[model samples]
Target chain A: MATTSEIQSNRDLFERVARRRRRQHAEQTVFTWLLRAAVLISILTTVGIVIILVSQSVGFFAEVSPWEFLTGTEWAPLFSPQKFGVLSLVGGTLLVAVIAGLVSLTLGLGSAIFLSEYAPERLRRVLKPILEVLAGIPTVVYGYFALTFVTPILQNIFGHDQVIVFNALSAGLVMGLMIMPMVSTLSEDAMVAVPRSLRDAAYALGATRFEVSTKVVIPAALSGIVASFILGVSRAIGETMIVKIAAGATPNLTLNPLESIQAMTAYIVQVSLGETPQGSLEYKTIFAVGLLLFVMTLAMNIVGRWVISRFRQQYE
Target chain B: MNKQESIINKRQKLHAIRVLRDRIFVVGFALAVVVGILGLAALLFDVLIDGLPFLNINFLSSYASRKAENSGILAPLAGTIWIVGMTALLTIPIGVGTAIYLEEFASKNRFNRLIELNIANLAGVPSVIYGLLGLAVFVQFLFNGSRSVTAGALTMTLLILPIVVIASQEAMKAVPSSYRDAAYAMGANRWQVVKAVVLPQALPGMMSGIILALSRAIGESAPILIISSLVWVTFIPTSPDSKFTVLPLQIFTWVSQPQHSFRGIAAAAIIVLLIVLLSMNGIAIWIRSKYQSRPDQ
Candidate 1:
């Protein structure tokens, strides 16, 4: 029934549509592949970080026995006798982390409870941003604050002889303040996520506001709170400038927060700030220390992720 | 009757105690907020008061000197600018592109989940570890032990990449799926839909996120310190290979000095650094609020 000329025009239109669709399909595939490459770069960065740390660290281990490096109590690699025990640094790091943990947990949790439970929406909106300003400050500035202002204040309280100029207390305290926002924000999110029914149920039982918040809301958000604490500890461990400037570079094996100590990060900065030649044992010590720090933070991060995901699954 | 009276009296006492406890808890929480805000206020006040005396044009323009009076932030400030500029150039495309890939293109499968996990982990890695990576990979291996500005910038790029990627991904995810659906209905393919519809909506978010991340990079000094230990840089860096120092690093050097005068100068440097960061953060916040308040298309 179709005329020949009409059939030819119809065929031409079909071909054009097919061509455009094919062109589009081709373009989509190419663009998708390009995007895949972009994703691959992130994986490559991880691999690169591992390779660089391990390869250099292997060279370091060959120079110094791994057992000696890990178990040694002394860490004065640059000084005479060249001791390379990493525990002293680890001890100092943990001391600071413990102080930071206590400070941030108590203060941060207190603020989070208030913000999530007590404060009205309008007040919360105004206050939370102001609190987050603490997180935005540079660690270096905090370091300066810790060294000049906080140390003097601590000395005034503890006596000048008790609180040395570069003791770990000031650094730990400031580091806690630095990480408080992270704790408060994440914990507040978890607290806010707790079902209102739980609170109502507590109220029905004649529970006070404080009792309900502490007993019901906090327990419901326990996993998230734990995750925030772990993440905060991990951050405290990795913090460099605060410890470097305020916590002195003396690698003393002491638990006293008032005593000057060198954190693992501070040790790396100490070595790097001076001229340690490449391939030397002292230069390679940084990579080794970095490896230890990487493992510690990585473990905490993994656990934190697991805890958060598990918590989400429960609520979801 | 006597037992019941005793029970009622005990309940009343317990209730009264709980009420008092609740009041105390409220006061304690309020005090926590005060401590946080007071800390911030004290820090700002201290920096302003200490640094105000030394914050002059000469301090901004001159180079570092052995003497506190002659030392300036010119070299370090220039270095910071160059490093951040190059860092932005390297990060924005890769970070945004990766975000697009993960959000729009990648199938929700095991492999994609791994990449997601990898990015999250990378975000948690310390800035100083990135410095060690730079020291090993970029400075020593690539540049033959030269602590060049290129090395520092590349180090910073890696340091901030995870942040930028995460922020961009958040932005891309926030773009409504309806826009994509509308584009697809118009015979646009996946790439076309994403390019034409999703990006415009996400651009404002992506820009703001990148700005915030860059502001963080500006304040970061640890990685730069590990990479470029040359503290007394007298001239501004001209090229990628030139030796450099950044604002925080310069401040660190000055702060380490025991001299009282050096602290003043360090405070001046701190002011400059704060100004740069605060302005960037303000702009980013402004952009976010502006776009967020606009009516949907």
Candidate 2:
């Protein structure tokens, strides 16, 4: 029923709208793909790290047998008769990690409980960020503190003859301090998540505040607390600078916290700092050690995440 | 009568013990908080005492020298700025894009789930291991063993990528869903909805996250140390490919020196690094609080 001119104008307008719609569709498609490529890059990084560690480690294991590398108690890859025994380094790593574990668990859990149960809201609000600053301090600075400050304090206490200048005690203690905030924050989050109903019920039963916190809130958040501790220990195991600068480089297979010892990460730094060439076996040892360190930490992280996720599923 | 009196006495004793234990625990917990704050205060005080004498304008302007007294942080300071700048440039786009895809566009599937898990795991990996990855991939394979600033930046980009993605994702998730629904109802396309509704609302949060992540990159030294290992760099990095040294690495070098004077210089460098880091953190915290307290939020 329309006139020819009117019909022709209508057709033109319809075509223009269609074209614009097509253009928009095209833009959406392009952006989706572009963003997808970014996601792929992240996946590629993990792949690249694994491939690099494994390939370089292959070169290392080609010359040094896995059994000897695993079983040997001495780790002197830079010196003559280069011992491939990784246990010595592992021992040092575990010794420091264990000491760090004790310190962090006590201090971190103690602070978490205080923040969650004891401190008034006003005090807690101010204290939490200040506490988080501890974690924000660089590990290198912690190393310096360990060397110049904590070492002197330890030397004075343990006697200069007993605690060597580069003993594991100071390094372990400071490393514990470094990781404390992580445990405190994560555990505090979990404890905070405990329902008010639970605390109220405990109070209704005439429990003290400390009793309520320890028996109710802590148990309720135990999985998350445990996970934080595991993650903290994993961090301690992989820590490099504190051990590298404060703990001695000698790979001693001893549990004594007062003696000098070399950690796996420290040894890797030692080699990297030296004039080791790219293709040499000394250069390759770092990769091999890195693979071990990666595996250990990755396993702990997985366990930690698994535990926390399980806890989350229960509540959420 | 005797048994009832004994029971009453026992109940009173138990109550007294519980009250005593509660008071003791309060003191103990308060001490824990004190120790944490004291540790930070002591570290700052120690650095101030040792480094203050050397923290003059001359220390900021001069270059590293063989003599401890003549040494300064000019080269490393410039290098830190360059590396952190490049890292931010490379990281923001990729990290935000990935976060958007996962949060908004991607279908919930096994592959996407794996990507999420992978990112979380990567977050837990040690900084030193990232140094190894950088040494192998960027430094050796990509750059052909050239320890350039670009290579260091790329390595850092990967190292901090997980953190940025996670933070950005959290920011995106914090955006309320009603905003998206309204846009869609108004005949907006997916990308249009994101551009018009989501991004503007999420920008402040993302800014805060990015600032915090970049602060981390600034303080990080292990990856840079492995990537360059050229501590005696007396000149500022003039280009991306110029061999560079960062403040942390310079501090590490000075700390390792046998001479006692180097410790003071190292402490001076630490003071500089701490000031930069603390200010960045303050800005991020400010942004976060500002955004959180908005009327709309």
Q: Among these predicted structures, which one has the highest lDDT?
A: 2
Instruction: In model 2, state the lDDT of residue B158.
Output: 92
**Stretches of model 2 off by over 4 angstroms after superposition:** A311-316
Residues B221-289 of candidate 2 have per-residue lDDT tens digits of 888889988978889889998999999999999999988899999999999999999999999999999
lDDT of 1 at B3: 100
**Model 2 residue A26 lDDT?**
97
Model 1: lDDT of residue A72: 93
Candidate 1 lDDT, tens digit per residue, A116-215?
Answer: 9999999998999889889989999999999889999999999998989999899999999999999999899899899888899999999999999989
The TM-score between candidate 2 and the true structure equals 0.98
Error of 2 at A210 (Å): 1.3
- Number of the top TM-score candidate: 2
